[model samples]
Target: MSFTVLMYHEFRKRGDIDATSPSTISVEQQYQDALPKVLFSYIDDFKEQMMYLKTEGYHTLTLQEIKDFYEKGTQFPEKSVLLTIDDAFQSVYQYAYPILKELQFHAVSFVVLGWLSNEREYFDPSISKVMSKQELEEMLDVVELGNHTTHLHKRYPDGTSEMQATSLQELKKDLAECGEYVTYPDVFAYPFGIYAPKDIERLAETGIKYAFTTVPGVNTASTSVLELHRDTVTLGCTLENFKTIVEKGASK
Candidate 1:
């Protein structure tokens, strides 16, 4: 059996980003879209998507299951689905949480540990607040929290990503600092879906078993655990396209 891992960035009460919204800035923000307010799934659309999953016989699975299958040839659960929300935006707690709880569905979140510790903005000031430690603790029953590096989720002045540019030593240090939050059998989702070949080797050395990318596809035993792909649901995604994206995948 195979599975699909999905990536979500933020949640919005309104169904669409208005021209005046902070996230819909006139100036282009390519890097940040990869981080925080890059793409937003409104509460309504999210609800519809989850409802479809619930009624359509789709069930959630953990990244560990995919890792076990790829590394040990364990059989994946039938009709497995994995939902991952990147950056741990507060809206996940606010808008996405209740609906998921109501449906009794689980999701994995890749949180930036550094964003949680300091008083800082991840992107648009109005929408980038991250969840607190207490909030994270409270949601543990349904949310599988994973490490998304400590401080290297940011972008450099030359448009290079911190994850792509940081030294191995620095990356290790950041991962150690983030260890306070990450639990066992750690899984990582790349910042902006970006990674290099050495990044895979580095992840193995770091004891990270699963790392995900934003590439569109479902996971099979042959899928590279270090470079697993996921589909991002944008606000423009129609319900029909959403279903197609999940059942198969977005055709490249």
Candidate 2:
């Protein structure tokens, strides 16, 4: 059967930025207030969502399982699914990790290398605090970490250039440095879910086997390693919406 991979970011409580909003400013505010309590609320919802998936006969798969099924022609259980989180938000450690451990589920995390040693607020201005090195190390014990990029770029008015090739290379170098700290898997998540065909080729050259995009779709046997689409789980997605995406499937 075809598989659906769900991509998530911060799971905050009442105050954290809602992933569903189109307006970046409002979302920024929400991200700033992402406290442990707020993060846990969404973790609760995520658990409930997983339970729903189980009832629907969906089997959660790791990225490697999906790869083996498609590339090596391995057999997968029915209703296979994969879970991934992009941008190493503190909430993943504070909230999501415990939930995954409880359910015995596995997930992949794409981390920004530059953000590792610095304070959280330095990387994503929306965050008030950052996860410390010790905290990140602890997280590594539970989840698979991948490259997100080094300096997460901002819009022109906000700071520097938009995501260009030069910026992409810089990000690549940042990821390489991050690899020194953590032995990330051969996977990547395009920052801001933004990428061009050239970017995909560039990533491939970096020894990345799988690069995930926020292109809002499902994966079939024919899907390519580059331009792999993901169904983003944001604030606007209700449990019903999540179900429809998983059941109906996604495409490029």
Candidate 3:
């Protein structure tokens, strides 16, 4: 059976319409309109989603578990799915963590090591709120922390790979240190869901077994671990959309 991996960002209660900037928007407008309402998703809403999935007999798997199941034919629960959160937003730790714990679901978090370490302070003031090292470490017991590079620049305006290789190299070193500090396996999640074919090869060299993308689709037995696809759950996605994505994934 195929497995669908759901990718999520901030789990806010209220929707933020202007949170993200478009490529065509001017820098000034980007600054002015970028700050959107932090939509708060009630804890109950989260529980309801999980309950619905469980009722439909969907099983959740961690990244490592997915690899093991495929490569080793390891026994996994029926109707399995994988849950992942990107960018290490504080709301993920604050709002999503408890609900996940209540549902007894395992999740993977992709964090930017530089943000957690406070090594670089320049960030979009609109979205500067990220989880710190201590906060992240505290939740390591429940969620798997993985690398999302130290600096998460998607690409240069010219579409050139900016700091991509260097960032991954530094991230490897930093994650090794973090593993010593937290004792978790070193995994990576590509930032902005953007990666070159070469980047995938480079990641494999770093011993990374799995990496996620923003691509919307289900994964099959033949899915490449380095280029794993994901279905993004955004503010605009309704419960129906979620179900449709899952159903379509199952069909694939």
**Candidate no. 1 TM-score:** 0.85
TM-score of each: 0.85, 0.76, 0.77
Which tens-of-lDDT digit does each residue in 1-252 have in candidate 3?
A: 677888776655544324454211112111221212323233445666777787887777776677686679776665777788766666677778887777778888876555554332333323525666666666765688766655443455555543364666675665555445432345666766677888887777767777777788888778887788888765555677778877766633
- lDDT by residue (172-238, candidate 1, tens digit) is 7887777667663368888777777888898888877778888988767667778888988876568
- CA RMSD for every model? 4.6, 5.6, 5.5
Candidate 2 residues lying further than 4 Å off, grouped into runs, are 15-41, 55-57, 118-129, 152-163, 167-172, 182-185, 250-252
Quick one: best TM-score, which candidate?
A: 1
Kindly indicate the candidate among 1 and 2 with the higher TM-score.
1
Model 3 — which ten-residue stretch has the worst lDDT?
23-32
Global local distance difference test of model 3: 0.63
Candidate 2's error at 172, in angstroms?
5.1
lDDT of 2 at 49: 78
Model 2 clash pairs are: 12-38, 13-38, 13-39, 17-30, 17-31, 19-235, 20-235, 217-250, 218-250, 218-251
Q: After superposition, how far is residue 100 of candidate 2 from its true place, in Å?
A: 1.1
Return whichever of 1 and 2 wins on lDDT: 1
Residue-pair clashes per prediction, in order, are 1, 10, 9
lDDT of 2 by residue, 77-146 (tens): 7666778876566666777788777666777877665555433333342452445555666766557777
Residue 21 error, candidate 3, Å: 6.1
